[model samples]
Target: MSNRIYEAYVVHENDQGKYKGNIEKKRVDDLPKHGVLIRVFYSSLNYKDALSATGHKGITNSYPHIPGIDAAGVIEHSDDRRFKEGQNVIVTSFGLGENTPGGYGQYIRVPGDWLVPMPEGLTPFESMVIGTAGFTAALGVYKLRQNDVFPEDGPILVTGATGGVGSLAVAILGRLGYNITAATGKLQKKDYLMMLGARDVIHRDKVKGQSSKPLLQSRWAGVVDTVGGSILDTAIRQTKPNGAVTCCGNILGAELNTNIYPFILRGVSLIGLDSGRCLMPLRKRIWRLLANEWKPTMLEQIAQEVSLSELDGEIKKILRGDQAGRIVVNLNINAQS
Candidate 1:
């Protein structure tokens, strides 16, 4: 038991139910008793983390919590034989940053089954940049491949294009020689989307079907939609016959207000991506692919590094839909080495 006091971003709920977040000192003993103790080196911000930090009851029923869904670090202690001291590992989702204390802290103790050995060819910083958002993107891309959608079929459309998941999906699909079209509300980020390998950029409004028709003209061979609601519905209706569309986030809305004509008439497949509860075998395979074949050439362009103390502004930016790329939190930046 080390007596070290570490700095972490803590969110506390007041008697009136208001939430406040700040950097504070926490002892190692504050961590939950679990299978492995990790000295987190890096973590990344996601939309879900923003919600958890801001007291979204749906994401976090309890407060006085640390919110960071993605973490990459080295093991300090282990109760399970599968993990040993000093081994590099990663943890994402599986109730992290929600009910459990998460990576906003310098240390986290979680079950061995929740950890993945850092794959070869990827650094801790790189892994966090590809965190939950990138993992979800990979899952969406995997579904497209599973449904037999290929680069030669036609253009692949990615909704929420400037977001972490959508941007990563664009990059991955581009790396595979696919024709990529990105849809975003932020037209100013046209160059950024193009740099991420999007062959074309379309206003998000164009993808939001205007008519009340159940199905629209086929426009995409495959779709990776991070925004739900109209964008998801539009993607489904506009998908080419036999095309696949993978849905992940619901930042827009949860309801799918579309008719069955897209599915029944066009044979369109709407696959759902859930990185949080994904099986270990599939998770491992996806990580391996991200490290290898699907690895983005412009990874650094997609990430901005920040210290733990600088998370507040980024959190606000993300919540307001102003953030265009990944924000990685470097825990070791100011830590005693």
Candidate 2:
């Protein structure tokens, strides 16, 4: 065992009840006792990490905590036979970065069950680029495909097209030969969406449902919705007969005001994605696919790498909806573990 001190981003509550985040030194001994101790090489920033950083009680109840929902690294120590030293691994969700000391630190000790051997054809950086957001996007796409939604069906609509999950979903679906119509609030990012293989781009406002009508014109054969509220309702309403719409985020709002007409009239299936608690078997299958057949060609274009010190500003950018594509955190910069 090595006695090492590492840098980590920690959020703490002040005397005034306000929360703030900063980089601090942490000892390996401070990590939680678990079967595996990993030296995190890369971690990706997600909206949930932003919430946890700012003291969102729903995401994190404790302070002085490390917030990183997705991590990719090499095992440094292991008590379980399933994992050995120097093995590459990835961990996402499953109570990580929430109630647990997460990958924001250089070294994290986690239960062996939460670890997935980094799949073939993916490096630590690439895996973090396809972090929780990409995994969630893959899960959504998997659900749609399982329901028989294919490229030949018609154009698939992707909402929040420039965001992490939406961007990855667009890239993956595009790689699978799907005709994609991307929707985004940032009209300036139209070219960005096109580069991700969106055949068409539309303003998010164009899809926001204003009327109380349950069903709208059936235009989309499938929909990958990241924003909830009106956009989700509109997608559901506009899906063609026997189409599927998978929803994974509520960045817009949480409530669903639509009626049952979409489902009853068109047989549209509304699938809800919960990547955090996804079954281990399904999760591993999705990761394998992501590393193989479903891998996106433009991963470098879809992800921006940032150092740990640069994370605070990126967090603010995500919260303001100003961030386009994914932001990956490189924890190995000047790190020792």
Best by lDDT: 1
Q: How accurate is candidate 2 locally (lDDT)?
A: 0.91
Query: Which regions of candidate 1 are displaced past 4 Å?
Result: none
Candidate 2 wrongly placed segments (more than 4 Å)? none
Model 2 lDDT tens row, 1-337? 5468888989999989888888888988888765799989999999999999998999999788999999999999998999999999999989889988887888889998899999999999999999999999999999999999999999999999999999999999999999999999998999988998999999999999656677788899999999999899988988999999999888889998788888888899999999999988999999999999999989998889898889889999999989999898999775543
Residue lDDT tens for model 1, 95-193: 988888899999988999999999998899999999999999999999999999999999999999999999999989989999999999999999999
Number of clashing pairs, model 1? 0
Q: Candidate 1, residue 247: CA error in Å?
A: 0.4
Candidate models: Cα lDDT each: 0.92, 0.91
